[model samples]
Target: MADLYKEIGNDSDYGSINDNSSAQTEDPQTSAPSPSPMTRHQYIVFCGIALAYFADLTSFSLIAPFYPIEAKEKDLSPVMIGFVFSVFSLVQFLSSPIFGKLLPYVGAKFMFLAGSWVAAGSNLIFGVLDELEPGTQFLVFCLVTRCVGALGASASVTAATAIIAHTFPDRTGQMMGLLELFCGVGLMVGPALGGLLYSVGGYKLPFMVLGAADTLVVIINIFLIRSSEGMESKTKGSMLAVAKIPAVWVIALTCGVASTGMGFLDPTMSPHLKEQYNLSPVFISLVYILSGSAYAIATPLWGYLSDKKRITRTLIVFGLTGGGVCFLFLGPTPLFPQVPTDQVWTVIVTVGLGSLLLGCAIVPTFIDLLNTAKWYGLPDDISTQGIVSGVFNSFFSLGAFVGPTVGGVLQQHYGFPWASTMVGFMFVIMAILIVLFGFWEYQCGKGRRRPPNNDLTRQVSVNYFGSEIDDTEENRGLLS
Candidate 1:
């Protein structure tokens, strides 16, 4: 156990074991310099990113509580409703990479502001959808507006991620966590606010109110965010090159798996609670709020731990394993026949705990991916960060697209209990694979000799061979 922790902790980036011979050929520009203290300018940039993230997520989730009911009133089937929701993620998944590739050429500030404006416009257009009579026209409008809104979201989110990474390279994990905290708050606030607005007016009220607020956020940021210099990279980043690395594949899967768990719950969880526990809609909303709150509250702590303690891999493994246990109880799966699924407390506790762990698992992934790619050979520039951010968003959006569609089908055919169990099994399987991979890495490290100097080369040797290399003559001997 001690050896495993040492292996994981010493090489938190999970540097590609097979690519150790390539390290000497790596671009020295890829090496991250020590991070300086935050300046007033950085704080301003962070605030802008945080507000933008909050608005993006709030608008993204705002329709959740009432959109299905409105769609049904328009005579759309459940599958059609699901399509409307899934299209957002689908467009985001496709467009994120494109925007990422363009970031170096166009600049992050331009993409961020432009995307915000587009999203705000889409929201305003969607507000008037109620005016159209229910039928094919309504469905067509829904899909078009959702696709446009998703494009805007993809641009803004991708740009924001790149900006934060470049602006605070040393604290990438912590900043990403803070942004996710805003996202969780947005998720919590969107439904409650949407339900409130829906009560006061009708279908159009929520979109109108939120759309106007989103525009307001954009206007504020226009002045608050300055164009950062030195953000554009000389070399174009290749997503294909980054994707080819095995370490990146592991990180992407970790991200996708975590998102899949969350996405699956969106459509199925409400209905399951209503059917099994007989909870009111308000109570159901509270349950979601509980989960979001847990996620929001725990995200920052996980980020702090990752940055301060360098436990990125450990958090990912722990989050997945712990989340799997929570999911089993969340359904009070038949596996645990004694646990009462009928009780409201069971749903609340398990979902909250599950989300808490989910936050821990996901918050460090961006930084982990960034460092891993750089360690393997990707340039450490704005271009590389943009590409990495794009790939990360694409995987996350892919999971979102797949999860709800599959979750809805599984819930329809099997029961929520089984559906939930399947998700649990996915988490456990991934966790086990990570552990096995770590053991294999440890075994490989055992064959290398430790060096005496314990300097920079020592760190490099540990990263590559799980052992140290002397800074002097031994370095040449090992390299040759």
Candidate 2:
């Protein structure tokens, strides 16, 4: 058996020997070395970051199933409810990019603590506000607080993704696949727990639990997490330098659409169900749990496929468009007052609606979109990735902003069907944009601009993914 251990330079950081053969290796047949203790340390911080990220997202997501229930409890209009959710998305949109810039200077530890505290404090406050008032127009305040909370964790997701991506450079897609697994688990578990808590305790329970959990996340980040400590750049840089790269523009747009699609399915869907069918709280909770599972299962498969076939962009186009059709099924059908609440058709309709929402392919498209960010000049550092991710997340935040508020109005005024109906159209638009961007890149040719060995990205599309444009002189010498 191979020794599975070896000595190499610069073991303090989590960098792997890019070319182990040239890294003073003992033998090719020798067993690969176990990751040094520092690597394990990095992994722990990554996991903590993931935990915080997951907790925040899931905390908000869990609200999906309960939206209608809360509406019923307060007799609040759907439009008002939509505004609350959209506010959180909007916060992420404006601040995520800011986190990117602020993180490098303020550091992840500070931002993480800041974000967690914002989330915890606000959640605690929301419970108090909700209990004291009826029709208090507190939606704006709630949203503002949530936005602040979101800003705190704004850069964490992309930061974590970039860290893992660079840590396992050769298997970036595979590692991303693993990352999505954690993401899926967080999303799935968060909503389910919320539903159960709501059923068992009441509306306030979910907020209380999330507030406490988030506070713990802050503590962990402060005490347990260690920074990657990146080296300085060889070349001086500026925004103009990054903007001049065409690939970056294409990636920014592509990621934006993919993110929009992901938002369409979850936080928005629960409210749609509530108004369309006038469903009860417990039932909505069940649906949310189910939907979360769909994402969880679909994401890992998408990552694996993107890795195996390197079909990042194609998958993005396919998943966004295909899964989008599920929203169409959710569009309001005329409701007859005479139809029994327990009619067999209700079950049939439920079965048919959003069915494709959980298929295995969703993860692939999403992974490709995120991977595309790096191709566009996103810094490889975790902190830089956070800022870069914040840029795309702005679009996702846009979707989050739009999905609920618009869906709410349409659902309230036109009925639940119309709210979802609009989302299906957004899906189509996103899909078209993805295809156009990808085709342009393909036509331009895979000149030296692309990494010399970007096989993983190439595999995302079974079709030839690029053109034969003239190679750049800078890349003439070596692999990307």
Best by TM-score: 1
Steric clash count of candidate 1: 0
Per-model C-alpha lDDT, please?
0.80, 0.54
TM of each candidate vs. truth = 0.86, 0.68
lDDT of candidate 2 over 293-317, digit per residue (tens): 5555556566555555555555666
List of clashing residue pairs for candidate 1: none
Residue 326 of candidate 1: its Cα lDDT? 89
User: Which candidate should be chosen as best, given lDDT against the real structure?
Assistant: 1
Root-mean-square deviation (CA) per prediction: 7.4, 9.7
